[model samples]
Target: MSGQAVLGVEKARFLYGANRVFDSVSLQLDAARTALVGENGAGKSTLLKCLLGELELDEGQIIKSRGLKIGYVPQDVPPGLGDKTVREVLESALPHTDGGEDWKVDVLLDEIGVSYETAQQTFGSLSGGWQRLMLIAAAAKLAQPDLLILDEPTNHLDLSNINTLEGWLADDDRLPMLIVSHDREFLERTTTRTIFLRSDGAHSFGVPFSRAREQLLHRDAADAVRRQLEGKEIERLEKVAARYRVWGVKNDAFHKRAKATEKRIDRIETERTESYVARERRLELHDGEIDAKVALRVQGHTVTIPDGSRKLFTIDRLNVAAGDRIAILGVNGAGKSMLLNALARAYDPDQEHYDGQAAVRFNPQARLVYFDQKMAELPLRTSLLDYLVAVDGATTKDANALLAKAGFPYHRIKGPIADLS
Candidate 1:
């Protein structure tokens, strides 16, 4: 810890129209590394925008140290940012464009372990995890940022890359960072400071995330104890008030005492601490028996690029049983997505057929629902309820119920689909 604040927000309040997203929020980014975490739509990203000076505080102010350069890696790569080589992407990220052997660029790439060969590959061609690493490398090196802000940096990262990032954070790079990620292990490994954003306010825990969570458990326990005590006190006061009113109905002394006790009860009722609610979500698999034993089959299937000259893979047999679970693992350019896409296209209701695959068959009883890793098919601009409703003409009320069952809070049902994280 430097014991000096790199960034500060004092008495800050942010609003969207009439809704106050953050109220009287005051915090300091002092440590070399910090984490900003909250449930979906708790204004974590908004606060990050406040820190980066992208969004102005509607009430208070943001204080930044002089000569501070902030680097930001958003949740997703910018739209239309495909087909460019990694080197070109890094070059574009730099303050000044130059040659491959640029001293500063090389130094930053070395810091992230992005070699010249990997740098030559198309940025868009890299796997999701590699792309995440590349983006981090670009943000860390290109801006030469004193403060780096990453939004869900571990979203697509594999185990190896997540470990790599953890190691990168553990090193004494001396770069102050405020990363917004829900990866608990990653946060425990990387950030020393955890700022938990709640709906009412933000709680800053000056410890690792796991320790912070333990402290939160303690606090919640303490709050429960205090609440129980308060409840008993209120009950006692109410009993006293009732006895006094009944014993001396016409006396001013008894009336005064009862009224005072009632006032005290009101205060206690209004000032109660918010109870902690534990959240648990799980997917319940159905026990229905499929009509067919073989849920899917692909015989002599080979996926190739559009050029038809490059062979991705040749599968002699791919038979998925009704209850079978399969995992596809491959390095970059290894056709994991291609294989899935081919299978999904094979089962498309539109009856679309690809030129490469010899045979693609699905059981008549089996229905395929492919969830893309990017979720690109989802409507980003729509609200969650609206998106679900529009998907199948379901009522908004029904959609809201579905989302609630899926663990979305009632307050968050109206939030934009793209901003779920």
Candidate 2:
């Protein structure tokens, strides 16, 4: 990887009203693929938007190489492209190029081992993972960008798709990239540089994610120690100055000494080491115990496609007890989704009221909470505080407290959820 800085931000500062997202953030991306990492709502997305020219910075500038062309793959598949064939979607990226460039789509699919049938299929007809992969292929191969930016590319992917993405990235080593992801293993395998975005600024390291994170945390610890020592020194100085003041009431020399001591204390205060105080944020799960030992049971259930024209798989018997962890594994296009979807569909809150036997049965005392991978249930326009307040038994004060604990600034609580990174 080249050491030359290809893209960078210098002293960048951005804010939402009085809420500061990041201040004095600066970093450079060279030929080495870089990972942009931070806590949720840490302004990583906002910073990327600033770099992509979608959002303007309040201070500083984004520097790029002359004629730099960037290809960006967002977290979600772009709207209105679901009706377009995979080949057509790739061709759309080359609108300004000559007609001869259409051949790149075929070459890209072949390079990634995609079949002709997949190329002819509509973008929306494919799984979420495939849809995202197609967009990436189009941006990288068809657009011919100088740099590629991928945001959470593995959000809805299965293990097979994730491996495919990793392989593609490994093969495309010539292209510089700025990837924003939370997948530690993916970053460790794909990126050579790591950048940590914080409320005060950004920290950059040449090492991969794990090593870079270790170095950053170490530096924070050292700063904390230094601050503690500085505090003790200041305390000692203050005490000496106080004693000198008491003696100076009777002597001019002591009065001069007291003034010098006070000056020393002021200098230490001015140059004292400052450590970062992280926001009170936590990621936790509801720890409620089920009243029944056996939470669910399944027997003779045949999982099928949405239209029920074809059967994917069948379960002779399956049991899930309370406090049990389960994992369903399969390749892409297999019956993993079919099985999960079938189970989710069978779960009804009123199942306890019905006495009829069924293929799937749940204990009456067991409660179910399903998390959709697509995050379709999240309301885009509602503010974080308002969303929490809407929850049963959650008061406005409680919501605000929870938001604070989740590292959201008080000023940003009223901002729409869509604005979150």
Candidate 3:
């Protein structure tokens, strides 16, 4: 796993509009399997796009060894249509056509639990899970490319398919793979290195995801301590300045020394002050009594498709009591989202039919407050105090306290979020 094809960047810079995503960022990726982990808008995808040569860096160069073939499975796959079947999709990854080697396709499909009859079926007709499985098999069937890149590859896959992919990824003979996945278990099983992209930029760690997380937390703690020490030094300098001012009124010798001391204090103040970094916030459920009384009740709910000929889904009955912290779990297009929308409507009946749910105070998943790794939604143009006032309706004092709780320095409350990022 050592001294393999080096994929790296030097002084990399990326910009989107006026926003600078990465400034002087750099990292190295070697032969070991690596996992890219970050929150929604943390530029993980952007980094991958750079690696795939889909997007060029604004101010740096990415160098890969010569003749490196990269196989990429994007986050979104093209609609499974046209003339391609499951077998054909897998075969297309190969350099030359081997139409006669039907057994190879059969073995792969069977290993992934897809029957030969199923392979003959049109890709368009299959469910999302099956299509995802087919794509995984296709990627695996490719002759060892120099690097394999899979972005959110587990999205629509089932447990079995994920396990199969995991086993393939864990193989020693397989080429180095860069996987962007939120599945902690998958990262633990396959990746030997973890690269975390933050608002600051990309950082590579030698350890796996779990260990990398621990290392990051420890680093933040140390940083906090360093900032605190700097703050104390500032306070001590301020005290010396005050003492000098008092002495300057009484003695001529003291007055000259006080002026020099005041100048030194001013210089100290001008030095860049260390600001505390905010850590990730975790949700804490309130400990309160929940009555058995149902907060929401849905019965015989069904959504008609746009064509008016097909029913997307039908749920016979569902109930949710007050204080129930429930997660609606299902694959994409599985009607879990539709069911939530329907429930919101049922709870709020004052609005029009078009306004699905108006009565219940349902926070849409997209609208729920999230402090992602990139802090994209943060008010970059305004100060931290202003941003807090805008988002949480907090006054200056309350906002400062909140920032402190989130590990921000007192002086940084007036600093612009853009500067922090």
Candidate 4:
């Protein structure tokens, strides 16, 4: 296969109202796998939309061969019709005819660990993780698109399912792919290149995420040193100028030398000062010994839906001790949320069973603030101060400080949180 399956972007520009999301951003995307990464609001999604022709560029051009088949797996699945089943969704992608190749769908479902009986069940009843898995299988199996774009494909998958997806991506002959994922390991394992979008625009590097991270860190360090040197030079110029002003009043010879030194200092200081690059805030939780006083423990926990007589999930054993900051690992329907609820006794216990010693003062996952992938659930209607009051108690000064740290402006604090998005 030729690398030119996907061509380069020549000075592309994308604008939303007055805000220019991409300004003369250029990149070359070949047939090799690539990863797109950026912080929230960096326009990563917008760029993908523009590439797919869903959004037209305000300036420049994206040239590609006609009839370029592209498959896009969105971060969130749209609500499906209740009448559709898991198998139906997959089969729908195939051309309807008697004696057609239905085996492709079957093979994919099996490979992705979806059972035949489960396939027959209604899609609406399936867990979110399972739906994500089915969608991935469908995209991979049905279209075999020349280019596959997956956004957060591993969001709901458990470790096992994630590994399965990783293996699929790793297959040497797999089609060219652009994955938008937060899973550092997944990007490292699958992509040969990375496209990072910043507030200013987008840039591409021919390296994996881990290597790219190292390069970025090294560049930042170099930039910091340059800035420090520039600052020192500026200080030196200020001191020389002060000495010149003081000495010029008394002695002619000394004044002339001081003036010459000041001129030289000014010329040196004329060089541009490098801008300081802001670093991403990384949250690091302290790791402490797990206390014997268990907050939650489950053994042989399983969830079975009444429809299709299929076993939805089966967990052998799970445990959570005090001060354990454990992340639940599973795909959408893998029953992670359900297990959490069951462990917390939020819902009926009959849905799942557990046998183990458990004690907990609080549900860390539930209580310790949540930043959902979709920011829609956040308290958008309330004022920043009001929202903080609800979460951390009513302290206006403390709320203002925390909101500022989170990037909320003083002027915007009083505005509805909905306006922030």
Query: How are the candidates ranked when ordered by lDDT, highest leading?
Result: 2, 1, 4, 3
- The C-alpha lDDT values of all candidates are 0.78, 0.83, 0.68, 0.70
Error of 2 at 362 (Å): 2.4
The pairs that clash in candidate 1 are: none
lDDT of 4 by residue, 1-421 (tens): 3344675567888765666565767776768798998775556777777788888889988877666777788877766644698888888666454538789888887777778788888887776667777777777667667788898888777777778877777774458888888899989988999887665456577899988878766766887788788778878877876787787788787688777877786676677454435434443455444445564455666655534365667767765666767776654565555555444443222423322233323322223334443454577789878888887786898878676666644666787875442
Worst 10 residues of 4 by lDDT: 358-367
Q: Residues 386-412, candidate 1: write the lDDT tens digits.
A: 877887589877777778777776766
**Candidate 2, after superposition: displacement of residue 90 in Å?**
1.9
Candidate 3 residue lDDT tens string, 230-294: 67777887787678678879877777877787677677667734443545544344534434455
Please name the candidate that would achieve the greatest lDDT relative to the true structure. Answer: 2
Model 1 residue 71 CA deviation (Å) reads 1.4
Count of clashing residue pairs in every prediction: 0, 0, 1, 13
Best by TM-score: 2
Tell me the alpha-carbon RMSD of every candidate: 3.5, 2.8, 8.2, 6.2
Error of 2 at 325 (Å): 2.0
At residue 214, give the lDDT of candidate 4. Answer: 81
TM-score for predicted model 3 compared with the true structure: 0.66
Report the C-alpha lDDT of model 2 over 64-105, residue by residue, as the tens digit: 887788889998888999898888888889847567877777
Counting only residues 3 or more apart in sequence or on different chains, how many pairs clash (N, Cα, C under 3 Å) in candidate 1? 0
Error of 3 at 182 (Å): 2.0
